[model samples]
Target: MSRSGGRWADETIHRIMSMTKPVTGVALMMLHEEGRWRLDDPVARHIPQFADLAVATADGGRAPLARPMLMRDLVTSTAGFSMIVPLHIPLTGLVRSVPVAELYRTLDLQGGSLSRMVERLASAPLAYQPGTDFEYGVTHDLQGHLIEVLSGQTLDDFFAERIFRPLGMADTGFELDAAQRARLSTVYAWGPDGLAPSPPSVTTTDGSRGSYPSAGGGLYSTLDDYLKFARMLADGGRAGGQRLLSPASVRLMTSSLLPAGVRQHFGQRLDGLGYGVGVGVVEDPARATAMDAGYGRGTYYWTGWLGSWWWNDPASDLTVIGVTQQEGAAMAHVGLPQPGADLRALSAALVYGALMQP
Candidate 1:
């Protein structure tokens, strides 16, 4: 995983990894705006390959799904998709090995085309009954395939036409051009020995193309470009005099959608937080273990694998972006926080703590 060498600047491009999820969510919601699907619609309705979806049992057996995997489950990350990956994340169950997840790894399901990925995903059993638990996994990749299905365009094309183009995010795309490649920063990882530069596992191909337009964790962007996006959702989905989603859609995206039993999986760093369509919602500051958690309710945020982060405070119309070319979620042998733990809570405390006094 080697990255091109460059010094970061205001225009320096980054592989803003998991942050791409919310953008994919926006694309799907746009299709929803077009009346293409319903929240409760069975995922099988669109992808019949999941018609016979199954769940895994502790005793090494498969059971029928408790209910159909719903579209909302995909958005909220409770869709029961397996979360196993080669690298380690700090969350529980995310790196756990199970038969279904093992299937995912053995097949290298993420390394292929979206259509093939979905077909393989449908063949594996879910980690739990749909909506019963939350494990950040391959569900959003399914959303990428869903977008392709409903929009009749490739994921990259759809993003450009409906999102990046509409918002004038000229610097965001799944692939980098020759100029962009030169501007991309060399990524680093924090180790017990201290910070060290490392080659990224992903990069632009053929100077302007990428192998995977993965909805789950793939996109290159700049802070200036993504701020335009975050502000749009914060301002009720309107940017540059065009509305990509209605106010209602924005609410659904920012409001906490995680259920009581499931949110605990977010673990301690994100205590009192809830998930809303690929972002984390601040539902209860009091419940947060961090002393500095001061975000207003409905402030939703997300971070990237390489420490790229953003949050939108709709209350005050404030949006913040932070970028570090370091691995936010290290391989976990040294037990670093996933997505730069304490980065958001501490930042919110300082920023909001000042505003309240003034």
Candidate 2:
């Protein structure tokens, strides 16, 4: 018996959707360690295409940007990139409209490479002024492009040679081989009666590599493989006997990257947590909701669009990762309640109850 009938074997590979964001953050942090760029640097300084980004006005018109987007904005997901909040709260008052989100889908940027995505995205106005608000759109995918530009390699190549290979996450990547594809778990949606197989996702990977590697939500990883990555974060960015990032950098990545006056709520009473580089930082644990679920105040974590979850707690020195392979709420732009959202709260309660210590 398992959460999804026959559950994923320990070695089974599953697509770890937005969970990919933190990995992208780690990759960018690697560049940060090399001093490739600074946090306050204007994103246009690196990705020149975004230099003239416009802001979409409510009346269907465009306006000049009030301020330039920064590297910090990208890291914090406040770059005004028309966040994709599906059943997601705490969005930009500007670009978080149904039309803009639909606009992102209309562009079908996922079908093309990040470079092309950049060219087209630059033509459209941002949902809001950079750094003014938080919207969780293509910031990580943009980070993927930034990684490619800084490292002068394709996103896949850089991830392979740097993070995955170094961490011994052999089976994880944007694309899967035939054997790995065989193990890719099927996603399900809860229907009226019970669980039903989900329709094929456009973001679903084929057996071959893709030109448009989604840094935000495109990576197939096994439980063991993702755990290796999580353990590395818990170990201060060291694994496989290699030092990937400094403890200071890890702190920066996990600390609250949001500017003041930005809402941190994610619906479902998740207001206590704050957004970090590519994950959620457990800030102000005194507040209730998912913010306090990590069992420690400084714990940092994130999850996938489908059904994978993970958290790294510095206080307790613990890392928890689980996959359920359910994909419904994310695909439903209507913001349907995530069928499994409550399970996380329950699971966390049970896990912390057993811990018996902070």
Candidate 3:
């Protein structure tokens, strides 16, 4: 089903993009279970640079935070910082008339080490007061850096020693060797004409060259490799008879954690789903069924930038993971229709229909 020229295989590696957020979430919660830090702990406790943050005003002024940003705020995306603004609402008029591609380029060029980037984030004016609303940005990346700070290990190393090794996920990681590079799918993007190959810098995973590990959206994985991770979550954090996370942790990670005020804003982005620790949880089946016929109230899923997607639906005892090289996976990118929005919905509909065909 992948847009890559060859038939999709379980071994093919593709940049899973934001799908990495859930993995980062699991990693942080693992530390949480270890008592390394509490969810409500102020982020300044570990990263002192964020102690005093200013909120950005529409009038081009700055305001103080009503409250400190909490670790849990990052987990639920209520941190008041985001990588993007709505297209119509210009970012201080800086990007009002800029093309999406140019905006992306500006972000790409601002890169530095993860910690350095976080420092830059701390200095920037937040869109709103922390813990007051939902604003999805690089919160997980901050969590990832927090993992390194608290665990005293690189994010990739922490994942390796803990989750991947125990679950038998050999093909998942930030960097890939020659053999893995060979299995990577050819990335394609939709242009005015049709689908065409995308540039390597946009699609390929070059861990050795990137400024920092993008705990937010940087891992490369295969369909089978990610499914193993999904299955672990669905199995109440157990895999192959080993418990990677406590059932309570899994439950908290999968359930909605948004405050009432934030819930409305989150709903605007994802109509029937609620924001969990890292993944999106199905809350209203009747509304979600409009997106995907297979989506049930408890189905949990997330998508990558390049279109790879996975979901664990308890209703049907279904765990589905798909890999594709389409440029706008999840329809998060520009130049596509609303139905072209997240191919995950389409894939789920088709898969569910097949399941019903006795």
Candidate 4:
């Protein structure tokens, strides 16, 4: 068994993968609080490149989109864009090799910008449409791009000033400096092949090579720093006596925004699982049978592409962060013990064990 020897107070940096989504979500909400945008506004209003997007139909053909994508759609993964297609195929890699500045130069949606990526995606068939079904993909990455265009600040800068700086999340951001990199935990994945280190490309965000800071997946943080952010969420967006977001905004971000029957569209029966703006909402704790968390309503959480996971349980005024690194879909099918599930179980056990001690 691989063990992380650090505690929540340790200043070790971790590669946070998709857990970056919640931070990006908070950034958008901060913009919302400032009246920079609204949930219902068409994304095209700011991102003109999406003005001519189309939706892919069942026959593998494209048609004009029925309506413009709303800002909220981007947050909820209902924007008709996806990172993967059926049979586990990736759709586009346009942004994979391009520099960040060059990526934003194209307006035809045929290039690598988030708007362009969505435009190309519009040409591909959607698993579902706007506000119809929930799919996890690059929506939050697009949100990060929107933050850049709308706020006129790079995603990293905006997050640092508005979210990280205020919340005392000192060890969280897109890239790590030398000091932080020295403390970064190595990422590992267990495949049928054997236990191996995750690729430096997959694990490190040193950014010495000028890689585009992917707001969606590009971030490194420490457990304690992240716990600060999570605790702020548990405290309704206040940290260190500073109001990072309004209580209403925090509530709105965590509220279930999916329409009825949307969960079924994913083809998985997540009995009590619902999606909030950017995090997973635990609606029925019992249905999370595969996880070790105490079943409860209103438990909001998310996980990283690596094995990291965190959740905020308001009922207990408690939050937990479990850090590790293992990658691939369906941890059970990956021929190794599922690190995420184990971490969740460990967290739950710790919480319960602490309670029993009292």
lDDT of 3 by residue, 1-358 (tens): 3333466677667788889989988998899899998878998898899988887766767888888888878788888765543343344322221333233334542377777777767666676777776666567778888899999999889999998999888988888787777677777777777777776655555434267787878888877788889989989999988899999999888888777645524213445667788887888877653355757677777777677777888878788887677766664322234334467667877888888732
What are the TM-scores, per candidate, against the unseen true structure? 0.89, 0.89, 0.87, 0.81
lDDT of each: 0.74, 0.76, 0.73, 0.66
Candidate number of the best TM-score = 2
Candidate 3 vs candidate 4: which has greater lDDT? 3
Q: Which stretches of candidate 1 lie over 4 Å from their true place?
A: 1-7, 87-97, 200-210, 264-270, 289-291, 329-342
Candidate structures ordered by lDDT, highest first:
2, 1, 3, 4
Task: Give the per-residue lDDT digits (tens) of candidate 1, residues 1-358.
Answer: 2244434577888788888999987887789889999989998899889899888788978999878889888889888887746544333434333566667777778667888887787777788888887777688888888999999999989999999998999989988877777777767765667767764443332234445687877788888899889888987889968999999998887787776666735322356778887887777767743423466666787777666778787666678788776775422212344434545455666787678532
Candidate 2 clashing pairs, residues 3+ apart or interchain: 87-335
Worst 10 residues of 1 by lDDT: 330-339
How does candidate 3 fare on TM-score? 0.87
**lDDT score of model 4?**
0.66
Off by over 4 Å in 2: 1-7, 84-95, 201-203, 206-211, 265-270, 292-294, 328-335, 339-341
Q: Judged by lDDT relative to the true structure, which candidate is superior, 1 or 4? A: 1
Which number leads on lDDT? 2
